[model samples]
Target: VNQNEHTPTGTIREFVALSVRSINFVMNAFAWIIALALLALALYLLYRWGTANYDYFEQRRVPYVLPFSAYGRMLTGRLHPVDAAGEGYRVFPEERFSGFFVFRQPGYLIHDPELIKQITIKDFDHFVDHSFNISPELDPFLGRSLFFES
Candidate 1:
């Protein structure tokens, strides 16, 4: 009863259906491609951010060893604390202090014993708050103590 084999306008109907399916497939692929591109961009930005502030010592003309990762030669640079201290001390013997990082935080290894004693004793009041504890979340007893307050 129909003009076409399947229906009255089966040729046009089949063509439209095929076009719609093709368009849908293309759209999905395009979306996936855009998503992947965005993910790559985000990762690139993170890497830049991590290493961005690494040259802090360089800007100030302070002596420093190249950072291992974003931590700036912290635990990763040496196996032991003493070894790490020795390395920093040996690098710039002429300099009074050497710059180091404890995960992006700048620190100094005072090579001079006199300076250390002076800072510890002469300026004890300036460094009264030695504790870096914040809240009693981990070690309930020790963290709760007033002596541990930063």
Candidate 2:
């Protein structure tokens, strides 16, 4: 009896080894497919997040300007913040207030003094608490600002 001889036990062992290799190959392929699917899902979710509030002012029938072009200019230093603000005001000169976006966050450009007074004084309490959270430990200046006192 030689070790190289093809005995029944040796044949069975070889078959088992080949089956394991095939199973491993299939499992690796399945894992890669699942990983690619998850990556695609994450990208789609990011896109949804970026566009979530794009139609916010439009749906409410508010006078608004799309900020993407201006935002891009500002990011590249081609447009100054003051110039961007002026542009927003010029776009809706007759409106008392106009809407705009900073990415997906909505904001207002108030062109009327009375409305500004109402929001700053008469309705001060309502606007006191901002919708964003800041950690004092990370950003003490902003976290301790009057607007974010609470």
Q: Which structure among the candidates has the greatest lDDT?
A: 2
Stretches off by above 4 angstroms in model 1 are: 1-10, 69-86, 128-131, 134-150
Per-residue lDDT tens digits of candidate 1, residues 62-146? Answer: 8885657323434466356556645677778888778876655666678888888888778766866553776678878877764
List, residue by residue over 15-99, the lDDT tens digit for candidate 2.
9999999999999999999999999999999989998998988999888877777788899999897777666688888889988
Clashing pairs in 2: none
Return the TM-score for each candidate structure.
0.61, 0.58
Reference-based lDDT, each prediction: 0.73, 0.85
Predicted structure 2: lDDT: 0.85
lDDT minimum window of 10 residues, candidate 2:
126-135
